[model samples]
Target: MAVSQHASVRKTVKEDLGAIVEMIQELADFEGMSDGPKLTIQDLLRDGGFDDGVLSNSVPLFHSFVLELTEQIRTGNKGKITSCSSNDEPLTRTTIIGYAICFYSYSTWQGKSFFLEDIYIKPNYRKRGYGELLFKTVAQHALENGCKRLDFHVLAWNPAKYFYNRMGAENLTESEQWEFTVCQGKKWMHLPKTIPSGSKPLKS
Candidate 1:
């Protein structure tokens, strides 16, 4: 099926956290990691600058974008359309179908870069160009913010890698042997003391 012409992408607001987290779980389930997602709506609110406690002028730790389509496009989809207007004049209800999460990072060799933590479209919504629309939207956001590079990781077996390749993304793991690593929980907490005391700082 073709993507709805009324589909649109925009920066996420505080209200979008619930839908975003739900889709995050859906993506995890699709990847065969149903228990992988550990984020909560409170976390998104704080990290995305939607929490009132967060300083208004401070840059958020992350940014998100969501893709929405009007109710007319989701007519027969069970449990997809949540609310509708009382009037009969073409229900203007919208539903969040996809989302992208991103954060900025610095590269000593390349300056500013943007990292796409996740991007996902509903299973029923895939193959209709919505994923590409969301991906391009994130890329444009990166460019507008002066990012020189956009980076993300895809599982070696994921078919989405082909889509990314078509969009001109490079596989650094294959081309440059760049491996992704992570440290969390106790390991991350102890990382500060792991450095040798006598280690000398390298000159910049």
Candidate 2:
């Protein structure tokens, strides 16, 4: 599907916070995300909308429309955005259809740069050109930033892999070169100490 182009993509501000949060919940329900409600409206407002907060780190200023799906259109109801922003920009609604979120990262193996994240469209709003718009928006941003690649992982169950492949994304049969490691809380205390690094076992 060729991406349908859009004329403007602007930054969102504090005023748009309510709508953003609504969308977050909508995405949680759509994705069947178990921890959706775990994130409350106050969490978003305090961490993101306020100065020096979680929103500042996790979401971009005005372009954090990460989840895609225009459920409101198909359901004949209004959708929401479940986050906050620095600017109160008007939420541009165009049968939102879907959303995509991406950020910059370096590929130590390839010695280049790329994007890693998800693009989700509401189940009911699929194939309405909203997905295309989101993809195009991200792709253009990737190119503009001089990134050599734009990539994402799609689950086998999604069946969107076919569409991604058709859009020129290469699939690997054996991705043995890549390995993931994350440390949090107790796990973070187990590793060797180097420059403020340590992983210690928890006390009973």
Candidate 3:
């Protein structure tokens, strides 16, 4: 399929959650880890504060942006447009082809930073600059929010790492030997209730 010339990026709404979740699965499958994603649309709606198709008054855990293409492209036997009309034209349809989800984080050394949880473009839409557009959108959002850095993890075997390298991203694992670690499953869910020895829990 040819790349759509009317592609644009914008903040994600609640209605986009379904598509986002679908794409998230697509990304996980592409990474050879199809079993990793366990989140649902409700999770995203609550965490991202997109319950009303807009940012909620309460603080949000994350934010997202979607790349949409609005064009007069029709397919199928009856030549029926399957997507919503953008300009009131029956043939014009808007489709979400890519998305990026991110959250703010604090670094002791760098103060504020942004962490990209996921960025995905549909398989058919690859190599058409949509990925770059989504990535740059996330970076720009981070800078606008007073973030000093942007961080994300990419699989070592994935070729997308080269894209990040081209966009001036640093591989801390290679340059600083910083290892990413996580404590989850049973142990994480069942932490000790009492402080060990003389160590007291800090007041919230």
Candidate 4:
């Protein structure tokens, strides 16, 4: 049967913390950004306090229900790791075939917008229409929220550049007059919760 014939996507909630961590690790490895998870299992279990907040803004938004599709077992013949009953159960996807991490934000250029921080589908899953579905879902949400655009970035080495091109996401290169800088981790961690006036760009 065709892959799309069974194409399904569901949302997973926060209670399935282990699965979220595993999928994240799988995604990191598959992207060749890193093979081993940068975060330990413990990080997922306890890094955020019982009252602690969610994923960092720059890290791609993973809210309580971020990974709805795989977590909920709403896609394909596959089901949750916890619910499968067969001894000969098929191997669960060890790589992230498709994902979208996003948030609502105000963009000076596009007014209020839906910023899609990341979307990825494993190489094997390409041409299956899953990626298009993911995009459509996000775009639809943005429209629902009255967003003028849905924005995201793709790295230079990523193979999906051509695919994004067909989707009409133009190549954005650096311009001479203005500069873009990114600050991550260590420094961002130490910054005050609220920045004082005239503070230089601080991440943490």
Q: What is the C-alpha lDDT of each candidate?
A: 0.85, 0.54, 0.86, 0.57
What is the full ranking by TM-score, best candidate first? 3, 1, 4, 2
lDDT of 1 by residue, 96-142 (tens): 99999999999898999999999998988899898889999999999
TM-score of 2: 0.56
Query: Which parts of model 4 are misplaced by more than 4 Å?
Result: 1-5, 15-17, 35-97, 174-180, 187-204
Residue-by-residue lDDT tens digits, candidate 2, 1-204: 112324233333445456556666676665567474565545545554444564455554223454322222121123244331334333333444344545667776654455646566656756766666667777777787777788676655667777787677777644544444458766578544543635555559
Ranking by lDDT: 3, 1, 4, 2
lDDT of the structure predicted as candidate 1: 0.85
Model 3: ten consecutive residues of lowest lDDT:
81-90
Q: Which residue runs does candidate 3 get wrong by more than 4 Å? A: 1-4, 52-57, 73-90, 197-204
lDDT by residue for model 4 (42-87), tens? 5543442322354433343432223232322323244445444465
Better of 3 and 4 by lDDT: 3
Which candidate ranks first by TM-score, i.e. highest? 3
- Give candidate 4's TM-score: 0.58
